[model samples]
Target chain A: MPATRYRAAPAATLSIVSLDLMRAVYHRASGRTHLVSEPVPEILAALADEPLDEVALLDRLARDYAIEGDAAALGERLEELVATGLVEQL
Target chain B: MNHVFAVRIGPVGFRVGSDWRAPIDTLADLYRDYPAPEDGIPDFSVRLFARRPWRRVLRPQVMIGGDYTIPDAAPLPLSLGLLAAEMGMNLQMALAQRRYLLLHASCIERDGRAILMTGESGAGKSTLAALMMARGWRLMGDEFALVEPETGLIYSFPRLVSLKNQSVGVVGEALRGARFGPWQRDTPKGDIRHLVPDGASIAAMAEPARAAAILFPAYGHAPDRREVAPGECFVRLTQASTNYVALGERGFDTLTRLVRDVPATAIDYPDAATACAMVEEFAA
Candidate 1:
């Protein structure tokens, strides 16, 4: 069986503003400001340019960051982004 | 509605109508320093009237009504009519102000720099601002700080300062010639008094200055000060704003610009002097 693919929503726009110790995402479409940190923003940056399936997204992330992560866990994070309407299943 | 008075406070104008003439007189005397709208049109209307037809003559409960009012809001006795009028004006601004990003914060200015202070209720923002006015800084606003989205400039909304509980006496000594409205005991916010801001705020109400610093103040604590990171400041400001959600993308741009452009810090103090000194030092 093949896993479902995901991509960034057309209307969703993200602006990552950095502070001393934290980063925030301004979701233009949702009108919601979110506080994010570390690897999450890195994950968001990975997903922001283009969408990828669970395995492909993790592979993409692994190339840039030394993340010893699992596909299932990475997939869960993608689902959270999906819940926030930042990305959707292709 | 017997008496109707139109006055402009800062960028917004209000036409307050009351069933009794007393509230109007009190408003006029307290707001004597404020200028009236030039064209005679108000951005919002505050109406203080009795709900039931005979309630005016019976219990004399005055219900505060305005451009936007809660249907089930309880009434205050006639003695608190001034309180009702002021609350009505604040309600209108909170619910209807849209030209700028409105924050539930106090603002003071010196030498073209504006310092914005916001926090939860009883954070001593009002008390601190009133004290600053008594010193030398111009009180830009006591309740709502209006920030222009394009320029990131803070405008003056120097309405009457609402001093609650013991802060009333604290402010009483600071005011030089300004007199507070009659003290009313046992309101929702404990003993309350309304202090009119100094004439400088009124004279410079039309002026706008750059936002230089943002401070989140907490009262009744040992003196402590810490820098708030951009993310923390952004979230706190969104919570502080009265119309952030309504302003949408404009609000996002403005608030992001504010945190990026202006420095933010949180200060905790047990007394007004320490708080003032901390802010002055930060501003310096």
Candidate 2:
């Protein structure tokens, strides 16, 4: 699993916002909120610190989410997250 | 006979009258006219109290009876005043059974789905909601729509769409041949109530819509339509909801699910006509 980074801001300074059900926790420290609902922990672990392509990301998410059996389920969830602005292709 | 309904909302209760009742009945019809995509049982119920000969039931916290006259005090926020003066005994009664949620909004239906027009007073959401109704959209309610939680559905309770001072002309002239109540002058909120649509279509509360779309209508001199990302819409709509806070965890989950499935947008229009067109275009 890749190193998991947890960011927090002191007090109620952190503002939380959602787009299309994508939850983002904003850090008053940097004014940029991390996408908390993207299953960051799961995806990072599946990626294993390696720079793989989009297909690799999908594979990791699907495997972690157990989408091998459901097939379309993992892909659909990812598309929804993308629509919510939580995940973006580099 | 006290011509008032004592309505208890959460912890607050008020005496309301027929001016409020008539609209609620109208809303029921509107709901029936355009049944929700998934037809469901109506939540509105009527109860008879033998001891109180003239009383009518509106909601759990509210009962309709007697006569109510607009207070002589300065008009409050026209929308708030309308809510405070609701005649629909079943309005709040219906609220208690479902999730007790209330919003200052105007609702209209297109393609059998209800799209809520909500914002703070003076945001022109009412005018926009009313204009949409004039253009064939069914009226829900001018001031509020009670949303049922489990289904994320809306219950219609039609009432007069309020038009304060300058808005009277802006809306009245645009929807030409509109019917309006006499304008009361010098109220706290200033004279109001330009027109009450022929809200006859309001019969039953709509089977709650799945919130197919959310648009923050911005009326500007220059017309523009801003396609809002769902994330922004989710943030705004959740905040705008009547029971967003009260619904607690369940409410949060329900809202998240609804926004996920709906397309949210921010619309700008120069006038009522344009606004109506935008709603139709989007709903289609």
Candidate 3:
């Protein structure tokens, strides 16, 4: 069985503003503004570089950020991002 | 049309036509200080008309219609025609204007910098802005703050300030010689009246000012104030804005810049005096 991978929309498609507590993302593709916090923005930024499965993405996030959640939490955040069209399941 | 009035407020112009003379007469008096629309051409037209010919006189009800309308909006009595006209103009701007980003907030300016106050309907923002104006701050606008997307400057709308319930008396007492419209009692939003902005505010409507800060005010609480972070400001402003979704990227860019450049605060007060003092302290 293969692990599910995900990719984010290109950097050009999103206008991201970093506020201290959260990020305000304006998705150009859908012309909608979304406010995201924590690992959601981190996941999108990590995936913007390349497609990553659950394990690879988590590894990248842990190396760069002080991540508190485990694999299941990361999976839930990815699913929510995918539903919002910010992250695509590959 | 039996009567017509034209006036320009900040960057927008309105030409109002009506079937009866009373409402137009009221508008003409209220907006007497405002200049006619540029070259006598209005950007929007508001029509206060009767549903039927006989409705004009028998039991006069002013139905608001214009460039944009709610379609199912209930008519107001002839006595409340000024409100209908004001509502008609506001509807047109809310539904059709896209040149600038519109925030449902009250704004006051001092020393070329503007302060925006936004909250829910009964948040007392309007009353606070009016009170601030009485204390020498320039009233930029009451119902809407027009933010120019290109420059991120706040243009003064400075329309008549709609005072509801206790606020009518509060502002009336504060602005001793200021002109005001008729008081209509027991309407949808309780007692209602409108106050014309000072001559200085009307004269300087075209000049835009830099936004210095954002304030979210809540009335009927013990006076307290706190700093708001950029993230919270972004969320509150998006909800406050009327044309954010319509402007898309432009709106996002402008709002981000505003949130980043200005400080935001939330103030809760039990009375207008406390709110005004707190505002003065902050502005100082």
Candidate 4:
């Protein structure tokens, strides 16, 4: 349970820009632009530093951002991030 | 709107044919400074047809057709024939141009440096760019700016600047010798007019300049400015680009280089003069 890993997908680089009201993410590998807000960016920034499994990442993010949310929901958000190649699970 | 005019603007060649003589004549007079590609055929075709067989003789409407088309697009009345032809060409370029990364931007060049301005509709990019031409900056293009993917060079397209609503009057007063097409009323974009590029822009259309900066300008605001980080600029550029996704890896690499190498800023200005001042200050 403690011996799991997750990192940004191979060859996938996230370039974030600050919009007037939101954030835009450019996925270099896909040449696609995504508009995101709030914790999505905070989460990506943290994960970009080091690989962490789902549970550990949520714990770290909750501490770093002082966020209060369901662990199951955070896990689902991590699942979506993995699907979009912004994050990975190993 | 049944004469054909072949004119080359920058890297793209266009053959515009119209069923009515008025539109073709207008295009010929406006584009008299440009020359057709002597050796090769035009890259795209713009055809203005009547809505019905008898509509040409009766009320008359100009339906834009071309090598590529947007299905169920609204038709323009014959009074707006020239605007229809221009719109058709812009549409084709937006949908089909692939050799370069097409940014939905107004580009102007000076001192071997080019600055690209883009934002949502009514951003005043076109009006400011046209005004900059009056101030001695070469107008590269108003509809789209072509960036060569391999070299990261910004090539000039220099199509006629389409000014909508109050911009038409604002630009009319700003530039004394600016050439404009017939004023169009009640079009999709209200009170439209086209301003032909000056001889300088026409002569230098083939020349390419290195991209120096990118700007996102917004009108109707108190004077303000903000620096845009490269990551944000890259993302906005992808959204502003017409064919970034279609160009594949070439688009990615070229855009990456642009955002990394050039600086980006967002400026809010109330009028063209203030906007022009903001650009000069930033580029300086």
Best by TM-score: 3
Model 4 off-target regions past 4 Å?
Answer: A1-74, A85-90
| Residue B158 error, candidate 2, Å | 1.7
Residue-level lDDT tens digits of model 4 in B1-284: 25899988887899998889999999898888987955659999999998888998798988999999988988888999989989999999989998999999999999889999999999989998988888889999998989998799999989889999988888888788788999888987788899998899999999999988899999999999999987788778888988888886677778777887889999999888899999887456
What TM-score do all the candidates reach, one by one? 0.95, 0.56, 0.97, 0.84
RMSD of 3: 1.3
For candidate 3, write residues B126-241 as lDDT tens digits. 89999999999999999999999899999989999999998988998899998999987678999899999998889889999999989999988998899999999999999998
Off by over 4 Å in 3: none
Q: How well does candidate 4 reproduce the true complex, by DockQ? A: 0.20
Chain B alone: TM-score in each candidate?
0.98, 0.65, 0.98, 0.97
* Fnat, one value per model: 0.74, 0.35, 0.83, 0.17
Winner by DockQ: 3
For model 1, residues B94-198, the per-residue Cα lDDT tens digits are 888889999999999999999999999989999999998888999998899999988888999998899998888878877767779888778898888999888
Chain A TM-score of each candidate structure, as shown: 0.80, 0.35, 0.93, 0.81
On lDDT, the stronger of 2 and 3 is 3
List candidate 2 segments past 4 Å from native.
A1-21, A24-90, B5-104, B174-178, B204-210
lDDT (Cα, 0-100) at B267 in candidate 1: 94
Interface CA root-mean-square deviation for model 1: 1.6
Worst 10 residues of 3 chain A by lDDT: A61-70
